[model samples]
Target: MGGRHVLRARRLMEGALDGPDGLDEEELVRAARAVVAELGSPGRLSALVAELAAGVGDPSGCARLSYRHVLGFDKLLLVSVGTRHMLRAHVWHPGSHRAGREDIHNHRSALASFVVRGTLGMELYETAGDGPLAAARYRESLSAEVSDWLLEPAGRARLRLTQTAEYTAGSGYALPSYALHRAWCASPGAAVTLFLETGAGRRRYTDVFTGDGRDGRAQAYAKEPLEVAEYLAELRALAELIGGSEELARS
Candidate 1:
């Protein structure tokens, strides 16, 4: 992937964010998917991923992130963080295990994920019964505070599991800001997922929930900041991991 392909990918990303405002949540997702689909196409997917991997060669352009809120990841790599969007890749190394199921949470921005390696178990949930009370369990925070994600005790509201599926290499998924979802990897090997978050349509705050959607308990987690040098090393490792995947086979 050269600079030309990288420029093309950036254009697609910007197109996803340049849509009209005031559209509904589903419409937002659709708009994002329509643009993201072009980047994921068989003709250009490899170049896009290669360009993202090549980006790591520039020490000034990459960062390593310790997820303060999301856990159970051996590594999380930040490819880029822009004003209206961000790109990240999550890697779960072999033998890593999460203590418990991940929280079912909603994002403030729309998201699209591409499975670069291994498999991911994805589940989406819809709020049933009292939507307002259900949405109140979350607190708003603009800073880096993991404690802010604690679920407040709101009365019980039903959470209907809407969709459950496994996305493997070459597969992608789009999610609206209003969709509540969680993910896990059942395989014994490593799993890698790349995400593109379009922040243009984001809200000020998003909601969070425990596994059962009723538990209000949450423990604050720590964050580790990574320097650009260390992030470059990690990016090199990730690029190799991705290059080895069958998903990178050219059409």
Candidate 2:
């Protein structure tokens, strides 16, 4: 028998993907928002963490997939149902030491995120006619063998900022796979968000835009997975943080 948390996560994903013909963009967004709301709740989140920390589920596999993303955040895979759906926790650190301005990029699959703590700021963009904000564009794909990120120069493009928004705890948002956007922690302290990616037919590549002009060479970033111990420690810390936050809210 599976752990309660694992079973609960599977049920949530099943409900989200229950549409007869699968989920459209709007439906996917709605499902993602609803699912995250439940998963990110303090009680449920704490229970999930506790269960995983106790090795009651597939924590080892989840740990192997967890890593610190190049975009300056700790990405912990909570549950993965093949390529159809995935649930993750993103912990974003504050301050300049974290990383420089993030590159504007899109994902291979439609995604949604719910802020569990602190705030998240996001900006949406679109390609524009030739202007001052010209940026170097790259087509990012994963290497077949190691899953390393391979960024190949794809020429220059100008982008126009379409929208800017901030989401605080208890709020969430979703976007299609092709949406061009960037996000960062907007609070004074570390921020945590529960993220969900849905859709089996993922795109092979994603677009990444960087401001600095480079030598037009393909760049590769290796993905380092976490060990079981580190994963458990992180989950413990996450549980404590959520418990503390809940107490504060109640008080």
Candidate 3:
């Protein structure tokens, strides 16, 4: 996104996602699909392109973050247009603390993130020792754990951090569930990445307790999927959406 185009993207993001119940999983996907569809018609997106790209001027590292409170985190949003299949751009926004956690409370979430600009720090981790982490400790510690997992997953409280090349606008990457991965801004630059995945197999987060046997009642990541009744049904439904068969999902 350059000049006016980013401005337009920003406008669309800010203006479109600001209301209550803001772009939750469903709305976000719906908006993304619409943006992709519009990109197909030059006649439709031409004016938008011009207006959006207008004041964007040049790429500045720091820009207003579109998601101040929406994500319940601090993050700026950026866009990317895929010339390939869907024409949908990856919009990178700040992720929640549990986005790539290694705690016992969290199962796994198969996630996909594609960067749109500058560089992104792909962090991976595993639980170190068996004590609850201080609030501040969790954030900073997890931020560094990316390296620990890259080295090996056999150790305790250990991690591996590897710096991939800086990703400029249009460059992106994917994070499979294999690595307890999460991304952050690596440069003084802004970025956007598209996220697609339900994360891990739909675990009965609310049904389980934390790793340390602590009550996880207050846990935000305690996800109770739609099928609070049958885990298999919910799991199979998600697998089918991604093209996997139910038999394979059961496996």
Candidate 4:
């Protein structure tokens, strides 16, 4: 526990020579030891940390972040810096939503997302092997019968989780590149989570993997590049099937 003074986020100009930028490939992964020092009591962090946690708890309620010139997007709030992967600050618009889409910028890196406040309903999809044309593919294995899934598995798993698959507030989830899933808000409002990557610079593959593999959530044991492509493609396809966007796919 530290002082009661609120946490003031230190600003780093994007692309500027700062504590976060200018690292090459190797340094990106095994860089200097990074840590987030708890500045406040165990009960409370600075205003910025607390605010970020609250936003992730309820993303639908989190309106897109807007600051005169800047668009208040949930994505913007999930900012990353240095090697610690600490959230310096966040800006959000309550009761907001976005659709299932890809970052498309870099797809080669391993990514993870964690939820803090809100709830989320996520699903994975894939594309048909017939070659990118056939209405996209979704991961599905006959679970004996759909009813069997509920009776045999649900009765046990349901208690621990919402039947809707919504991860509640105060909880966070880490999603891989190939896990194409969307967040859904319950009857309440916006929810939140953090998206993180293992590598650096502009990610190689798209951030969100359009599922096109066998395992959406869990890939095979092998670490082949095809495996990465497979799982990732499947993830994206699933998200695309419905409206991966915030409002449409929002649970």
The candidate scoring highest on TM-score is: 2
Candidate 3 off by > 4 Å: 1-108, 126-166, 198-200, 205-251
TM-score of each: 0.72, 0.92, 0.32, 0.36
Taking the tens digit of each residue's C-alpha lDDT, what string does model 2 give over 24-47? 776787788788888888778877
Estimate, for each residue in 86-181, the C-alpha lDDT of model 3 and write its tens digit. Answer: 122222333444232223211233333444334565544444454343211121112142211111122123333333344544444443333444
Candidate 4 C-alpha lDDT tens digits along 1-251: 11122223223212221344465544433221121222211222223333333332322322232111112222332234444343322212245543232211122433444444445555444333343322212222223333111101111000111123555534444433344343444425444443344434443223222323323342212111223233333223322322243322322
Q: Which regions in candidate 2 have their CA more than 4 angstroms from the true location? A: 130-132, 244-251
Instruction: Score residue 196 of candidate 1 by CA lDDT.
Output: 70
lDDT of each: 0.60, 0.83, 0.33, 0.31
Task: Give the per-residue Cα lDDT of candidate 4 at 175.
Answer: 34
> How does model 4 score by TM-score?
0.36
Between candidates 1 and 2, which one is better according to TM-score?
2
lDDT of 2 at 105: 97
Q: How many clashing pairs per prediction, in order?
A: 0, 0, 27, 65
